[model samples]
Target: MDSSGAGAGAASPNPKCCVSLSAFYNNTIVPCPNCSCNCKGLPGAKCHSEENAGSMLQMPHDPLQEPEDLVRCTDHMCPIRVHWHVKQNYKAYWRVKITVTNLNMVRNYSDWSLVVQHPNLQSVQQIFSFNFQPLKIHGFLNDTGMFWGVRYYNEILMQSGVDGNVQTEMLLSKNTSLFTLHEGWAFPRKISFNGDHCVMPPPDDYPRVPNSSTASKLSLPVLVFISLLPIIIFVGPSHFLDYL
Candidate 1:
């Protein structure tokens, strides 16, 4: 198992650059007031800044003065925060299970998505399906297969209730797979959980061409031509003089 703190732990400061699960899950998406794009002031606009404080950019799909379904967190007992844990004794091709709790008093989530990412591997990206419902106790349930070796962290994105007020989310998972969790996560912004869509961080690395594709393109003649480079370098000038 790869340690979550190794190659996957590297960090970059670009907001567009993806980050690990721990860093990705810890932040919130607030509205960006400086964004001038005319796309209904949604949170995912490309030009939002994190430096300014208390400035709100509305949800990309939400209207400015529309009625919002407001729910208060009376669960002083549970508190308003994201919580999650993974069992150590787990195994499979991808056997990772995580749970998130929405400790709000009387609210259920309308839409939610689970973000699990790793830095080293590409085939293991998994975003669990979201079912629209405000979680009363343990919040909504979402589980993903353990696809790769290890994961660094996990992120839960939420849009709550009928009006999509949003709720506290959590992060959990092995540190290795969690490395690039923040690749596409939006921060310092509030979001409405819409069943129709979920925000995903772009790939930290591009996909590689398959070995079979490369093999099919190269043949015996091509191999011989490439192999002659070294011999040509040693005997080149003599052959060039003869040609001249």
Candidate 2:
């Protein structure tokens, strides 16, 4: 998807949107603009512990499963690598940089998006949204910080029309709650979240066809038999009548 077309004004490049290691810690944050919204905080971000790190919890997912996990610090379901960066102390507000890469090629990408939930805030900021410009790939694709300074926290959805290739990144900030971030969609099909990655489970006990569609649609044998039927009956009679 070329960004040079009619709707090209949607994306802008920035210095902060490039890949940079965090000055605070071992963390690294990529820059990407965010969309703003005032959605409520997630319920479970208030209480977190190392003991509850690997615990399983129910979470919503997009129709298609993502190849990488959403959270990196835990072993829940989606297993994509997650990095954290802070522009300043958490007193006023903090900025978060998140990176998500596609590792699966089974599904075509259309409505890819991310949602971050914070449970410890009285109010939240708006969420700015952007996506990697589209390109073709034999298998996978990646987007690493194509937009920056997004300023919002509610459901942030990426722009459509992307070519699946390998490695992608998106940046977000917490305008409302304490800590909870998600990346997935609900469009193509129902997906299941296992913590490390989103999984598209096979249909629930859907029945299979009795025969292969390729073999079942053949009519060659019937036509051949009909073509030879008259030849065998006619040629054997008139020509051999004198001999019989």
Question: Best by lDDT, which number?
Answer: 2
**lDDT per residue, candidate 2, 1-244, as tens digits?**
2221112133222110111123233232322112111112333312223245334223444545442222212222122222223334354454444443322222222333332222221232432343322222223422111222232421122311132122222233344443322221111121111111222223321222234465466699976666666765877855644543
Q: lDDT of candidate 2 vs native?
A: 0.28
lDDT of each: 0.27, 0.28
Off by over 4 Å in 1: 1-81, 88-94, 120-244
Give the residue spans of candidate 2 off by over 4 A: 1-23, 27-84, 130-244
Question: How close to the true structure is residue 41 of candidate 2, measured as C-alpha lDDT?
Answer: 39
Top candidate by TM-score: 2
Backbone clashes in model 1: 38
Give lDDT for model 1.
0.27
The TM-score of candidate 1 is 0.22
